[model samples]
Target chain A: MTQFNPVSQSAGGQASFIAVDWGTTNLRAFLMNQDGHIQAQRDSDRGMLKLGSAEFESVLSDLLGDWLTPDLPIYMAGMVGSRGGWQEVPYQQCPIKLEDLSEHLFWLTTSLPNKVAIVPGLRGTGVAGLLDVMRGEETQLLGALDWLEEQGRADESPIFCLPGTHCKWAQITEGKVTQFSTSITGELFARLNDESSLVKGLPKSNQLNEDAFKKGVQASLQAGGILHHLFSARSRFVCGELAADEVRDYLSGVVIGHDVNDTLEALKVVSLEVPKSPVLIIGSEALSERYALALSSRDLTSEFLAANEASIRGLKRLANRQAVSANNPTTGAL
Target chain B: MTQFNPVSQSAGGQASFIAVDWGTTNLRAFLMNQDGHIQAQRDSDRGMLKLGSAEFESVLSDLLGDWLTPDLPIYMAGMVGSRGGWQEVPYQQCPIKLEDLSEHLFWLTTSLPNKVAIVPGLRGTGVAGLLDVMRGEETQLLGALDWLEEQGRADESPIFCLPGTHCKWAQITEGKVTQFSTSITGELFARLNDESSLVKGLPKSNQLNEDAFKKGVQASLQAGGILHHLFSARSRFVCGELAADEVRDYLSGVVIGHDVNDTLEALKVVSLEVPKSPVLIIGSEALSERYALALSSRDLTSEFLAANEASIRGLKRLANRQAVSANNPTTGAL
Candidate 1:
């Protein structure tokens, strides 16, 4: 693996390409110029899941509007590269450096004539040596790496906690993503908070009950493990220890707490160097803070990055590297 | 708590009462004669949950037909006694002998003039001192004692696993329920297999793939715990390790296996005696056998009792005791 180096884009003022972050339920796009600056941004709910009947090209063309230049290259990340999306891109295996992302880009033979490519996802050995896969987080992880090197923390091997519907915990050593694990904590909480008997009659909201949520986090470290602690949400509510409105947040705490603890424990079990440095928590402000709180509860420190920005930045770097390589064919590393 | 004594009915061969096991999803009623024999049996899908708008009495009346005799005392158990049921009967605390159930039966002031009653639920300390609950399983636990005593196994102190949508694990010592825990394993599996991304677009069914189910059981014992292990259902499928039809049963195995292991571990942690004798698995034949497989995988022996029989036997014993005490005002033991 190469030592982490910030990719410097070629000197050009005009717009270069577009970056699309397509996931299961939402689509986000960033218009990037020659030097990795966001020219403009747009978002829509026409995610990969909703593009079942709608053609991906038509959706992209419609959403991008006048920005849809035939010559401007577009680099798409996330489920847009998944099986059901615009095209199925194979996942690249782990232990690969961030810069390698540019070389493995799954270029499309689109109607626009070699003007589009999808960032292939990553697969790695996760907790218990079980196979774990991530579609979108890998890009954010690359952005995370790029961001870290820019911060002059490139030599630091730290754990990355990307909390979302399916949270990803990546262990980056040197410049390579050595190993990572995935937790369905968010998705589990979503399903239970919405449909499980645990919250059957309770008031439903995305609003977090802070104290209740922390109580759930505390419950995770208790004797019974995830399957049992989950019942605490319902039992505590039944016993009047938790209010009806607090049930969802309390459950969220329970699952998220367990997710963080288990992933950390698994990393420890594998003898990974859990850095003394604060864990890099990459996601939205609310969730990242929630994770930071959970980590702090265990006396572990953490920092955060907006997931969208991470993806956009990561895609921007990839575009820059690809552009630089194309401009100077003799250049090996950006 | 008093030692469990077999409740022999009064000397008479007349149709005396009915035993109704009404839960959230289904209702089963057994017509009992003067003794503990089931004279007739009937079942309906109009369970307590479905009785939201329909009157419980009207539903019973429509289903039982001639069996709904005004004077035919009906002893009901399960969710029929829960908050949303026919009547809200309070839960009896643990450490009470099975026979104490007779004293706590919340007799209803019904249209039939003191001819109807709902057996209460049970509450107790569970894993990690977290309060766990069970509504319908109490009646089964009572019946379990009756059946055990009938088999001259009254001295047994065993872990009782009543598997269902909400699985119950009760620690029975000296014929008394000392402690118990509830695992939402079945419910979790139902929701995940039917709805989650783990099994999304995969084949869905209640059929168990023995190989796949056992593989899941093995997976539970591996690292990363439940949350991470759960993703294997999807990860394995995406990587072609698990087949489409096997996903449901595999998930079933994972949850059931964890449920069994966690409950036992919780019992051990709480310093409760997980008896050397086989864990008593009470439920439908298929579910009971499934649990037995899970238990055996941990090198634990288990025995099964038809859940309906247990409930019927329990309600029958309660009826016999109530009838005997009513028949002979001076008799303390029938």
Candidate 2:
């Protein structure tokens, strides 16, 4: 039931630490040296959704293996910190300084030396003053800011688009996350394609049909908005205008296109530089490129920072600040 | 496997015919006399979705029971005429006179008798020139139009909104369906409330929470569009701004509100009298009321007609034209 948080007696000299990006469907870990350079890495399907709350300790410990030393602190982000996850860490409110994430680290109360902690997610005011929340992506945002600072582009406020099942569009003012909105674009596409009558008999294909994808993006830019554009998939397919192999990608375009469009529109309501400002996409190369294509189709520029690297940089940044936070934690007592 | 279409020899003297509204999930039949009066009605869950193409005849015959007679013609509408239904009746293009439906009836070639036919669905160019398809809704639209004409409102080009699993918005100009669009509002709401993570831990209920539902409608009018508005359900729930019991209705509000908003916007792109014109809503009292609530919040005037009346009147209207069609069919041969 327990991986017995690595005994403090066995931990002497270790300049290494572990960073785990544990989300709903996937998990990845990194072992970094004193300089925040990756020494080793491991990836698994043991996501928080697949494990019971009690199993988190064991699964995580076995994952770390030799890397699981008491002095080698472990930091986790995403759904592992959610209510049904390992510890249910509370979210920190934003307009939050990305750098202050380490100060809000929720340390687990293990019997042995304390080294395990979850990077708290962020809850911020979204469009129309409604609330929005993000877990792992907040840490990724922290890491992305770190990556941008290294490139000396930190001062230039660019909208961060994290493309995934629940896509997020965040705006950074200075070093703090001023505001952000989440859209279930990917999930909606999946549900309609798989379950709804829209793509009932349509063959499913994973390959992206570039032409259809871009056409869908153009359709999304039209007057009907998404609900109408979505029907266009069924309508076009039935009319034999869109091919069987193109339905999936075309759907991807419609969904992501609206996501990009709606978010930009919402951002424009708050900031003047939105439509003009370039976007920094923090996600996988494949998906981020899709976002990039959707953006470029609208004549907007975008750059990608590998999502994994951003999370690692985010965790390392926190690890560096961990010592400072330990002496004088800014977070209120739970 | 065959229900053996009535042998025609059994005909004596019968003035009754069947009008079937057969859809994906349910089927209903009305035994109507020559005077357009319902003699009897039967309903079943044996929708087209439940039976194979070969089994339609048997199922219909069994449902008809003692009502089955060679002299009685059966006119069916909805998905029953879809490719996977009893027969794959092609869609009739729009800017089409609703009264012309009987001319396009897809008469099935029964060896014994030619009494079975499917009321063909309609195809129309929706927003951005995308082809939109509707199966049963076309017949319902016809019925609604007939009902309107009887009330001396034939010249009025009211937007016909049939809200259901796949809600449809139709514009009828000069007794013809000029344009229409289908929004996956109801289906989207069902999918998110049941399968998506947005309502993962939330309680489900059938009761409509007016406060929450209206809030969602109001939310849709804001800058972020439906995609952003959808996430508000989860975000608001997580922040304790929304209650568990209210999630479902609230979600319905958001989806239906967007459905109403998007379709109206698309209609305005072509028609000048859209937002100002009255909307004739053809659906059940309860569901139509929700739509009415959504419409009224935006200061739009709407009137409801029982969905069943619309379908029956539409079928009766077609029956009156069937003899005319038999003499000179307007539809090209399959």
| Candidate 1 runs further than 4 Å off | A1-13, A327-334, B1-13, B272-274, B326-334
Taking all chains together, the TM-score of candidate 1 against the true structure is 0.93
TM-scores of the candidates are: 0.93, 0.93
Write down the lDDT of every candidate, Cα atoms only: 0.79, 0.80
The TM-score measured for candidate 2 stands at 0.93
Worst 10 residues of 2 chain A by lDDT: A1-10
- Residue clash pairs of candidate 2: B143-B314
lDDT of 1 by residue, A43-110 (tens): 99998888863388888777888776655678889999888888878888898887678888877765
Please provide TM-scores computed only on chain A for all of the candidate models, following their numbering: 0.91, 0.91
Q: Which ten residues in a row have the lowest lDDT in candidate 1 chain A?
A: A1-10
- lDDT of model 2 at residue A259? 89
Question: Comparing only chain A of model 1 with the true chain A, what is the TM-score?
Answer: 0.91
Model 1 error, position A25 (Å): 1.3
